[model samples]
Target: MKDDCPWFLGYSGGKDSSALLKLVIIALSELTSYHKEITVIYCDTGVENPVITDYVYQTFENLKSECLKLCLPIKYKIAVPKLDDRFFVKVIGRGYPTPTNIFRWCTDKMRINPVKQIIDVHPKATVLLGIRNGESKQRDRTISKHSKSEYYLSQSGSKRNQIFSPIINHSIKDIWSTLKFNNFPKSIDSQKLGELYKDAGSECPVYRELPGKSCGSSRFGCWTCTVVRKDKSISKMIENGYSQLTYLHEFRNWIAEFRDNTEYRCAQRRNGQIGLGPITLEGRKVILDKLLDVELKSGIALLQKEELIRIKELWQSDLKNPNYIEKTAHSRVVKVKTHPKPPI
Candidate 1:
């Protein structure tokens, strides 16, 4: 028999998500006849580290294939934002500045909105989030607020969708205990994930920053993230022998540098405030050129073909507009190491 309410687990290829995935499987497995569907959704932000991206796909594939062989009623897919809403298009085509902590717009447009759409379509579904109390005080508060019920309801249109967090109050030690008890998905590196957490480092619009500490060894976010003073994850990865990510670190730094330079930004904000708006046309082009060069050298397609196509179209359209202006361009070269093969 099928349960009326399906479970939607959000997997971000991180430690919390991995542990949550294991718990969900163990729970379902215990109820041998539980035939209702469980869907796992992965939001690929296109700008993810190539190595991380590869791991995510490979792991998901292994899980899917294994589930089929085991005859487990599980379904999974990678969710992607529309082409126009993708990271590269918004930056190069729309000339939007890279996201910052003050006005971090990418989370809503590229990550949350797509998942919201899923919720709207799948009524009565319980979305499983992998949030742990040890991560932040804000998270602790959210868990406390929702503690009264096993299923926390969300208003999506006319229907009420439920939110469930199995490990909301779990500390790092508690989480490891559960993982040790359950049979983890084959692709997950349980030992490495545990060690990474020992070293250092989302929800209803999760504050990118945690409560007590700033980002450290566990910050596995976009290589292009400029919201903080630095993206220590990519830096750590490079130091740990992932030399391929060195160019990304430099590219992200360049974006931060360019944003601070008045010459590469608009004279006025969209609201006419005495501040910058989108990045200048010339600067956007420079970024695109450098990105393409990196793609060629690294042997991995950095920006999608559709993003480039739309960027060219948008650039042309912007040129025809009388209000648009072009700033001076500068010559530069991006340095990158060659990868033996694409990180597929």
Candidate 2:
């Protein structure tokens, strides 16, 4: 309350973030005078689990109405990646392989950078997160390494912006209690969240800093995530009655396998180096066809119209000069390790 600088709250529609938001709203309500404006930011990766995405959109609507009703100084924003950076545009248009642990490239483009762009406008803004200490051993290590105090952490590469985690010390049990018991706003439905948790697990962080977990590790993450060998959260959701996810689940599995298939990849890298290159033009066509089929079967708009236009533009440009570098002319060559083929 003392600092009057603008505050940006990162909300991932997860239990921890939900609990933290509840506390923030309650705190703001009790304040006699507002010192600063608070903006709740959510990064929609475009490929988020449909079930969780619906819930989050509805919750945002509810929060907007309720905050106005209570006369709280709060705003909401949904951040999204650029057209060229969207999942399908990269994978299908550019023939980029689906992300893997070693070559994981999706998180920054789809998640963090979108949110970071917002924060960058406010140089002195404080970013409030819902990170807790014991969520995982790696998380715990990260917290300890960057902690400035009980509630503050160092925002790497930024000396001006401050990072504050209100629930840094909150336990898993504490988070549940806060969500289940808090009655204000009435938008965060603890029961609904519980059901999601029962089927899907935790959520990926909306705005991760240095040393953070990649996307697809949570229920609220991208449905097209292939970083993990299998997306257990979506699988569980399908088994637990989310039959609509069947096609998406199958496509994710298929694409993960297809990404490693040598037949579908170019012989030269985009940088002109000799290595496992991007998906071949033929491979990209196959992917787009299959993705469209999945969209029709699942009744989900996986690719936006603008994204498709962008993809076509990219494809046309690539056709003009298919090779990034002429393999014979390049002096430096790197041998790419072949990956084991997925089960046929």
Candidate 3:
């Protein structure tokens, strides 16, 4: 309240973020005066797990109304990746392979970059996160490295902005207790959240300034995540009665397998080198066809109309200038003469 800089709160609609949001709202309500503006931001990656996505959208609507009733100075914003950077646009549109641990490119483009774009505009802004000390060993180490004090930490890759984690020291038990007991907003349904977590596990971070585990490890992550060998989270959810996820789970498994088949990939790299490259145009079409089938079966809009338009445009461009080059393993490099140095 004493600070004049704006605050951005990262909310992932998971337990930790829910608890942090509840605490922040209660604290704000008790205060008689407001010194700075606070924007609660949620990154909607479009490929988020359907079950959690629905919960988050509903919660957002409810939170808005509830905040208005209490007359709290809170703003809500849903940040999304640019059209070109979206999952389907890159894969089906550009023939990029599904992310693997070695070539994982999804998180930065889809999740972190969108949020960072918002925060970078306000260099002095303070970000509020739901990070806790005991979440994981890697997470604990990150916290220790970046710790400025008990409650504050230095924002990664920034000199001015700072990270303020109110629930930095909260235990798993304490997190649930906070959500259950601090019922000020009423939008955060602890019971529903608990049920969601019954089959699910940890959540993906909305902002990835501090690296630890990848998003594919979480049930609340993208449905198309293929970094993990087995998407146990969605599989368990299906067993626990989320039958709608069956088609998505199947598609995810199929794509991971499809990505490994040599017949579908180019023999040359996109940069004109001799190596296994992106999926071929025919392979991309096959994947798209399967995805459309999944969308029909599951009654979910996996790809937007605009995304379809963009995909077609990219296909036309790729037809004109192919993404791969016809290079052989024994191809020799052409040496070029270097320019003469400028006289001193």
Candidate 4:
């Protein structure tokens, strides 16, 4: 509740976050006359697009310079998710399946955990989020819930070290307008950022099911995201001549093809009943075997290497029990171009 409590600004290097940062800085400058300390936090997922990472660094530098000019005590911190702690690690290493829409597991592990740790360290801080109502229906629900909490908690919850979204009420148009009005700091490469957004065909793959709902800003996301059906941001990189991203694009396809594999999935539900649908474990396993073949050719592991080894081990163990493995693995239809055979 104290005004002196530090502020944690969550900057994801996206348009919303960038705009929020600018607004937060503007507000802090006015409040600095009264002595306020604001710190910026960027959760690094290690899988952020390179361009996004560059912009984040550049923007931080610009903010630092501005703080120095104004004699403010705002600091910047970056947090990263460990590779061993990723979804692949769990799926490949521990025999957990990839997170699905109904059972989304990546968010809590990757996105929320890293940032929450930083927030927990500074319990007496006002967290600055970059949620804009225009982003999505879910965002609207989140903002509405927080707004209600603000009133019940008192003082728009501003007096408490509560979450504050400065631009929550603003529309997407308003964000661009504000940035344009101020000629946005040179630290951000607006042109390239614009291009990235235009090409970003999907949303952050942290939360499952919503493909094309997230965009790759500059940083902080899982390197292997199968949830995103089309990774336009990575594709953009390839389009712009960043050939390394080609592997990423191919990897996504490999995962997609593998998701339907029967050999890789269980025939019976965890409850031990053969599912009653055309989409049975047998079918899934068959698809998975074909997918595995493609993945082998592609050399992209959907799960981590350790996870894969464990899965294979499980398959071996399951084989001992005839009813367990059941040879659920099946083949998929592969189109092959053929030439006329010579007469025998």
Better of 1 and 4 by lDDT: 1
80: Cα error in model 4, Å: 2.1
What TM-score does structure 2 among the candidates reach? Answer: 0.91
- Candidates 3 and 4, the one with greater lDDT: 3
Write down the TM-score of every candidate.
0.84, 0.91, 0.92, 0.67
lDDT of 3 by residue, 164-273 (tens): 88888889999999989876779999999998887566777876545677768787789999988999888888999999999999999999999887677766787867
Q: What is the lDDT of residue 214 in candidate 4?
A: 37
The order by descending TM-score is: 3, 2, 1, 4
1-344: candidate 1 lDDT, tens digit per residue? 44668778887777778888887776665675865678888877787667767777887888888778777778886777888888889988888888776767777677666766676577778777777765667646645655544444322233356666677667777777766666555656676565444333522222122233322123445667777677676777777777888777788888877767666666655454555666666667788889888777767678887888999888666655555543222212211122122211
Query: For candidate 2, what is the lDDT?
Result: 0.82
Worst 10 residues of 4 by lDDT: 335-344
Q: Cα lDDT of all candidates, in order? A: 0.66, 0.82, 0.82, 0.54
Clashes of 3: 0
Global Cα lDDT for candidate 1: 0.66
